[model samples]
Target: MGTHVIKMPDIGEGIAEVELSQWHVQVGDLVVEDQVLADVMTDKAMVDIPSPVHGKVIALGGQPGEVMAVGSILISIEVEGAGNVREGSEAPPAKPAPAPVSEKPVEVAVVEPVAKPAAVPAPAPTRAAPVARQPDERPLASPAVRKRAWDAGIELRFVHGSGPAGRILHDDLDAYLAQAEQPAQNVSSRYARRTDEEQIPVIGLRRKIAQRMQDATRRAAHFSYVEEVDVTALEELRVHLNHQHGDSRGKLTLLPFLVRALVVALRDFPQINVRYDDEAQVITRHGAVHVGVAAQTDGGLMVPVLRHAESLDLWSSADEINRLAKAARSGKATREEMSGSTITLTSLGALGGIVSTPVLNLPEVAIVGVNRIVERPVVIKGQIVVRKMMNLSSSFDHRVVDGMDAAQFIQAIRGLLEQPACLFVE
Candidate 1:
């Protein structure tokens, strides 16, 4: 038999390590070539690693949630047939495998003390004198319950155990703590109760987001600009288009119109479609516009890129945006779909407030935010009329894009949105 060690492949650019999310195969299971062995998470995307050779799995590297470095031994396999097997190519000595993945939390068994029967003759003499009571021994509780009691500085003996077999439970400790903090008689104080705090481990995508936002805030000088656009004409055109092609093509949204307008405006101002290289002290202006749509999912904020947005027509852009947004919210977007964006667009839908200052997606120079649209009285041609108005809040990296250029670029978008026909023009 020939033993082969498979290492973790580089999943994406600059990804040094990945968290092992799950394993499909276990030790001693036979696996085929090109078969998925495990799934690892990196760059906020799940990547499945396939086996290289058909063999019986000999070992697994680590458990789920463990971070494994790239090029490290991920799994070992033993294959049949060894015509050219190297000398001393024997499998390493086997060690006991880890506990099965289905095992529950670690449990420490508690041994209850057994009472022995006393002699009948001695029992009568013991009643002649009363024995002194002894202090309570350590309480019977689980490790977690004990830790909670310790953290709260409450003795388990003082708290009543309500669990099965008189074991102390977490709720018992909480009740005891609460009762002890109540005011005595008529004296009341606001700071009498102790405050409990929870600690959540910052890991996975959340940790990456925190790090990236902190780095951007420290390095980039952010300048925000807000402008109001009258989108009544655009909304009218959208309603008409949806009515005409609602069944044949998908219903249109304001996003696709905004995307096309931004694409057009980018042509006039290419500086906004650029990425900054801090280490190299250089800026790269991209000709192709890959717009990242900031989508909020149950997991967190995910930005899925619409590649070559500048080349796609209005309908095609709308379709692709729908597809990408669905994939991102459902946690099915690929690494490529989530990366390589020149700029970004964020919208809060109906929940969007009057205005918001969106943070810049790192390395990119600009981000456009769409706020809630409201109908309000306005003076058009010296007459009071209600118009559908929406605010466009945008942020730019001051070091790369000047304040004047940012304002002009947004104004250009406003002009297209107000006209509603220029977006469809060539």
Candidate 2:
């Protein structure tokens, strides 16, 4: 009989491969069309792959937690009526009884790992109670919810669900926390005994973010130079412009203005807008500017690019940046918008950081870091007065961009911000 092979399908853009995070089917199991076969983690997000045809699984191509490329064979299936067959191999031997067409296919149960035997045996009286829900009778839940429960150290069996088919929701986490109660001590006593130390396991998105940052730092040659800029006039102009425009729905943020300033700065310092050719030992400068705004998502760090950023007006830039950032945060950014960035801009003001040295996006020569603009008392005209100020830090690849060029590029940006009128000049 004929056998069918299922190959992995495209899950995302520019992502040729993904890590198989979970496998739902195994050898000798019956699967149907649209049934989830596995979950794969792409660069942007995690997606569940479904079976394309009905069949009994024969073998899997890769193990869970292993990365596999797109279009690679994922599983081999034995089609109904057409038994398992191999190329140039002998036919299957006849069974003792003919296989019934109407009879349900028997599933070959997967053997789970057996833990080591306990040191002591339990009492016979308490040994037997009642069997819990069988696998088929149990309610269905999304793999993400199950993973969250597992990570929170909560038993799935004990949690109540509020989703379709009785699936668990994130709100159920509160009940889990309530079930996990503390006892046997007063708060004062517990606090007295508590040492000023805590241990947290790094897992999920935070863990992945940490790993990627470590990788970026380890692989790229990063050189950062910080310059403090007086943005008092810029901030005042922004406020006045916003009031005059009166676009309540689309209030201008410091970012779009910053992006506009950067575009102008790059017009003069194009080297800062180029990508480094690590292999060819050359820097390829782009005629157009595609600026990526680094956004923090629930999954991890995602940088969404605005194509032809230099050609857009300040309002259009603000609108698109707003849309792209929103999309990235919602995990709906398209692949094209997530890739092909010649440079990037990172902001940590919402989190309240004064200054930071951001790591370079590989293949890209530089990244600009935006910090908080606060009112700090300073000596202006030999008198102490509250003035709005911010620090801008630009990190560049020393292999491609010289220190003088980097410094001047950053200074040009500062000059534009301080002048506020040069950004609009021809």
Candidate 2, 1-426: lDDT as tens digits: 467777778775567977776679777789999999877666645566788778887777777656778887777777766443566774433112223366677788999999998787343231222234566676456788778777877777776665555566666655557546645354346545654788865544455467677877876778999988888999888888789884654678898888888899998998788887777878889989999898887666888898898889878898999899898787567667877899899998667477798998877888999988888898989999888888997798888889999999999999999999999998
Please tell me which predicted candidate would have the highest TM-score against the true structure: 1
- Each prediction's TM-score against the native? 0.72, 0.65
- C-alpha RMSD for every candidate: 14.0, 19.2
Q: Which parts of model 2 are misplaced by more than 4 Å?
A: 1-4, 10-16, 22-39, 42-64, 75-189, 192-212, 246-249
lDDT of 2: 0.77
| TM-score for candidate 2 | 0.65
Q: How big is the positional error of residue 109 in model 2, measured in Å on the Cα after superposition?
A: 26
The residue-by-residue lDDT of candidate 1 on 1-426, one tens digit each, is: 777777789886888999877789999899998999998878657688998789998788877767889977788888886622365764434333586775577778989888787755322111122222237556678999988888888877777676655577766776677678767743566546657899976655666577778888888899999999999999999999999997888899889998998899999999899999888999999999999999888767889999998889778999999999899887679999988899999999999899899988888989999999999999989999999999999999999999999999999999999998998788
